[model samples]
Target: MGHAADSVTACLSKGLGASVGTIIAGSKSFIAKAKIPRKTLGSGMRQVGVLCAPALVALEENKAKILAEGLNKIKGLKVDTASVQTNIVYSDILKGSNITETHLCKILEAHGVLTMPKGPFKLRLVIHHQISESDVKYTVLHSESCNWVHW
Candidate 1:
């Protein structure tokens, strides 16, 4: 399980590096600072080629899915921006409505959508693998239902 988890983490880190047009180098410099015994700390798993194999497989299988999800999130953000009528859509809304982003997030969660409040009047809607087109529409509709007037 540790090997599997490490592999997944490594794969993800690599993917992140690639998306940003960065290269990841294999270095052991960071391991030198470890004070814990290898056997007891399970750090002995380093340099295990077998674990890397599964990580590689996971990366190949999941890369497309991850990219698609990212695209969906970008689309959701665009939708949110287009639907906004107020300039202070983030933190100011919270101040006037007496509702925190977390509270609104719960509301969205109940509606089968998920979001985070950015500031007092600002909120951020995050689209994930589980969110569908209908979910995005619902969020837009729900946000539109709110009557926010700027003073």
Candidate 2:
């Protein structure tokens, strides 16, 4: 069996970058309850093997390397290193900061880095197997270089 992106958010879109959820392991009772909500949320898809195959590969191969990259790599983006336990990293903008989240997002996106904004000055950055250490450094450097006040 190959690796898989075990995620509740379909792996690809928000969870594991698989574009589909594959790994399901829970008590029968728990699964039964979850299935109802899963269906209600339209999480099911046809011929998911195509997506699952890659997800499996990823889980088996890249899990450790990706984890070791760490959440503290992104400079200027403050994240409590001890608190990060997964691929998600959250950063907040100061109340009096000149840059807004939207402005920062646009600046990052312009450089081919995409991020999700949580609030006017907050951002949620997700790290995955596709992101390399060099990529992280570049993103951090570029992010720090953004002068949103002028824009």
Candidate 3:
């Protein structure tokens, strides 16, 4: 049997809505061998139920819909449609926009639009169950509204 529970947290972090968890997978013996080390990092894995329970419910929700809205509703950010086979979204900051990726990230955070930087002028946004259509809209609007960047 080749049963291994790999990085299944994406099912929750990406599909459902959980803050943290990068689970790994391995055979039984391997897992047993790592038990001591895993336990050594005890509380780091605490309160998992806080994230797991919602993930279970997320399985029943429409993951594709969110992905679609996220893909379609964006304006100022450019995404390659050909590569959007999954729930991950990458937005490239338009060149000559005058604002660097770091400054834009700070602006988005100020407006409650959280995202990760993929490059000097790129951002990675993930579509999850917790994100609603309005959230996507807000991101697009705020991102495109960087008027001061033109100067």
Best by lDDT: 3
Off by over 4 Å in 3: 1-76
Tens-place lDDT per residue, model 1, 81-131, is: 333321112222434555555665666577665566776545654333234
Full ranking by TM-score:
2, 3, 1
Candidate 1 lDDT: 0.41
Off by over 4 Å in 2: 1-20, 27-77, 147-151
Q: Give the TM-score of candidate 2.
A: 0.54
List the pairs of residues colliding in candidate 3. none
> In every candidate, how many clashes are there?
10, 13, 0
RMSD (Cα, Å) for all candidates, in order, is: 11.0, 7.6, 6.1
TM-scores, all candidates, are 0.34, 0.54, 0.53
Candidate 1 has a TM-score of 0.34
lDDT of 2 by residue, 1-151 (tens): 2235322343343444555544464556766777788789977634657767767655554333333233234343455654445456677665555677888888889999888999766788877757666777777767766744444
Worst 10 residues of 1 by lDDT: 15-24
